[model samples]
Target: MTEQKLPAATRGPSDHTLRDQIVNAAMEYFSHYGFEKTTVSDLARSVGFSKAYIYKFFSSKQEIGEVICASCLTQITQRLNAALEEAPSATEKMQCLFQTLTVAGSELFFRERRLFDIAAAASRDRWSSAERYEAWLRETTVAILREGREAGEFERKTPLDETAAAVYLVLRPYADPVQLQAALDTAKEDASRLAALVLRSLAP
Candidate 1:
């Protein structure tokens, strides 16, 4: 009987390190050439690795895009959290969340349009990263709603899950890359107005 060979990813200098190297190289390539135009072969050549080696780490180009998209979303979430922390009240936190997301999305759409495209694809395809980000945003909004109710700033009549889901839908335009790009010109103003409307609806 012949013995089977193990994949490079399984016998490497930390799968994490190898994965990071490929992702970093891909990011650089994607930044310059855009995601749709760059192929796995291009990435493999750019990283000085065989296409098979690349495959050993990622199943498809979309998987690589997922990693990059997740990183970008993580940064936006970090900014949102920081803004929330600085806010003195739940009302302010909610406002902060909307504004921060708007600004972050706008920055990515304009400044890093290539990456934005990748994120847009991820959202459209229902990638795990996109789903996770949406979940986190909803959970965070629920927390804010709970805090507002406890502080007598918001009404408690609506069910928490329902309210949170509604809030998430309202913020979807800013969080969804494709929608965000289309609304870039009025994103900030729209976020402010929408947040105000949400606050009014939540008032005790």
Candidate 2:
């Protein structure tokens, strides 16, 4: 018999009542102690809830981390969308994508190191939040490429999917939490240079 695949882990408790209280308290605790170091028990204690009560909403500490990770990444994507909105052309949007990602990643790494740890763990463990963020990035890149090609600003020789995938691969260092930390020193210069090269290659 073929083995059945397990359902994906549930992110849990999206309401704005008790669940929000638990998550808000957990975020503060995680931000101070870091995600890997924070436990469900510790979170419960910090929030004045029993461990069992906390478990009622979240199955594990990782679940809470996933919520926090998703929130953080959502902020980055929001900023990216805003930057893209102000750009006049697809070329500017592509460039804005790189610059915004690098700046946002660096800000998280330098100013919110504890939160960054959660993102790094999410990336390392292939968490749902990270997966979703990556998918959004790829889709956004593909949209930009398609727009450029249609406008006669970019060449149409390369298949859209392949080109978008290649672009994402080049962008991974600045986008991945762990890799971004290592690339931080050169991230600005690298993003600018890479965006220029990608733009040049895309020219019709």
Candidate 3:
């Protein structure tokens, strides 16, 4: 008498292409309106479907929200991974990353802005995945520092783990309600400088 939990795609559209469209439309609705404010009706219209049609694809708002959050996380990680692979030096990789976060003349587009908005609003009881994401970013920066140390790019004796954490800590305020005012007041503020402080911690 146990109920079966269906997979995301198989629960509705088995075709991967159609499932992507459903999620993309939902992403737009969620971003244009806050998660709680977005209705299934609005989401359905975005996809040229009826409210009933959406229910065929997703069980509830939470279900779609979870999928949206996961999709965004996967996307940014993929982008960062690709950038990391192309970078011969960690400094350049880290620089490329920070550049993406705040610089307009980069691949990180306005589309990414919505993802960040939703990520900040998701209802995850455990922050492990989010923390892990931040940790991975820190570790990537640390790896870059290690490479620099060997190549005579850095000369200091600071602890690597601490420096890595600091890199994220500087950005943490942007997500926090209190310090986020700085970001809201001016998007042009230098996240790169903060990241540079972390990078320089390894220098002599």
The Cα local distance difference test for each model comes to 0.88, 0.86, 0.61
TM-score of 3: 0.63
Candidate 3 structure quality by residue, lDDT tens digits, 1-204:
122344665656454556568778877876677666888888788878787666766777666666766665556667767777887776777676665544421223243565554565542333444555556666766777677777877764767677557666765553332244346546435666766775666556
lDDT of 1 by residue, 42-157 (tens): 99998788998888888889989988988999999898988899999999999999999999878865797668778878889899999999999988999999999999999999
Superposed model 3: Cα runs more than 4 Å off: 1-25, 39-60, 104-116, 123-129, 171-189
What value does the lDDT take at residue 103 in candidate 1?
96
Report the lDDT tens digits of candidate 2 across residue range 1-204: 122222356364344466779888877887788887888888889878899877777788888888888998998999999999999999999999999999987886568766888888999999999999999999999999999999999999998888998898988888898888887888899999999999998898
Error of 1 at 108 (Å): 2.8
Cα RMSD, each candidate: 3.9, 6.4, 5.4
Q: What TM-scores do the predictions have? A: 0.88, 0.88, 0.63
RMSD in angstroms between candidate 3 and the native structure over all alpha carbons: 5.4
What does the lDDT read for residue 146 in candidate 3?
A: 73
| Top candidate by lDDT | 1
Q: Which ten contiguous residues of candidate 1 have the minimum total lDDT?
A: 1-10
